[model samples]
Target: MEHSPVRKLLTEAGQRQVEARIKAAEAGTSGEIVVMVVEESSRYRHASVVGALFSSMIVAVAVGHFQGGDGMWHFLGVFVPLFIVFHELLVRFAPLRRLFARKGDMADAVGKASLAAFYAKGINGTEAATGVLIYISLFEHMVRVVADKGINEKVDPDAWPELVGGIVQGIRSGEAAAALSEAIDRCGELLSRHFPIREGDRNELSNQIRY
Candidate 1:
């Protein structure tokens, strides 16, 4: 199986820390916050193909030079099978493909995944519709925040980039748990300022960490 850096980083103790962070983030607001970490956001098929093709071409040229090939038959013999094999090998190794993918492509995939989680995890179904999702894709080193309609109406979308930046710093430092904890505290401050705890507020979402 392919290695999942995110899962490995968030060990049992790290998961517990994230769960605690969620609880603390929700302490003073009706807004619900959910965090999700995933191994990757996309298959990056083009990236795999590009890497394989480029590498295979270089190797095939070297092979042909050594083999003293001139005709189409010799070139085909040296390059065709080698190209196929290398392409398959590269595609099979996800990390190699991910290495070739552009940052923009990865960001787009992360955005889509965040939206999917927003709905799949019932973040959009909260009673007050103040649900916020903090989604991280380890392979791409991307962070996304999805806010429900209720929160969007009141809070400017630009307000989230700073929070996301903090999380990114955590991931970069290899202290994902601490990074998320700090971000959650920041988010709590933001939510409490705008939403605050109401007289009959109730916890509407689970605080467990999602992987």
Candidate 2:
């Protein structure tokens, strides 16, 4: 059987969604509310790694000084900050967000939103209309994928709780793409099961499209 391009596009779209989420989580947001959220998330991860390294290096240095040894202290002095600098570089250059979104203010929101919309389309199984899909894709690039902390307050108030809840759950669980893929499959199954287009309906749709 010939492979369907739709399936490939949808799979790529799903992978992009997961990667975008990981990038947003790592890069964080801006503005007053967003800044706080970003700071908290970054600190949470940084504290563990930075704090442990700092403590260990300090202990080693102190012990070396007490024992009148220069080797361990000298080595740690160079190693500690080098590690910190490298960690900062990774955080700054995380490939996920960098590849999709431009490195600027507008780019951050637009990039995240675009990815989310693609994810939503994949979930809804309505990605076939080239024009409509492209139009919706514009909005996808505009929406901000704010950090997961306190998302309820950050997102639009009118959005369905279930929708927001699902995204939030995916972010927290670190399985947004898997969850979304499963959701899309479930949606497809439901559509096929309950609203399948019969031969007559397919003919009608084809006619409508032609006209």
> Which candidate wins on lDDT?
1
Q: Which lDDT value does model 2 have at 194? A: 29
Tens-place lDDT digits, model 2, residues 117-153: 4344341232221111111112122222222222333
lDDT of 1 by residue, 1-211 (tens): 1245546667778888888978987989999999888878888888887887788778878888887878778777777787788778877876677778998998899999889989998999998889999988878888999999999988878889998998898778888888888889988888898899898888998997666
Off by over 4 Å in 1: 1-6
Question: Which candidate has the top score in TM-score?
Answer: 1
The TM-score, computed over Cα atoms with residue i paired to residue i, of candidate 1 is 0.91
Candidates in order, TM-scores: namely 0.91, 0.26
Candidate 1 C-alpha error for residue 83, in Å: 2.6
TM-score of model 2 (CA atoms):
0.26
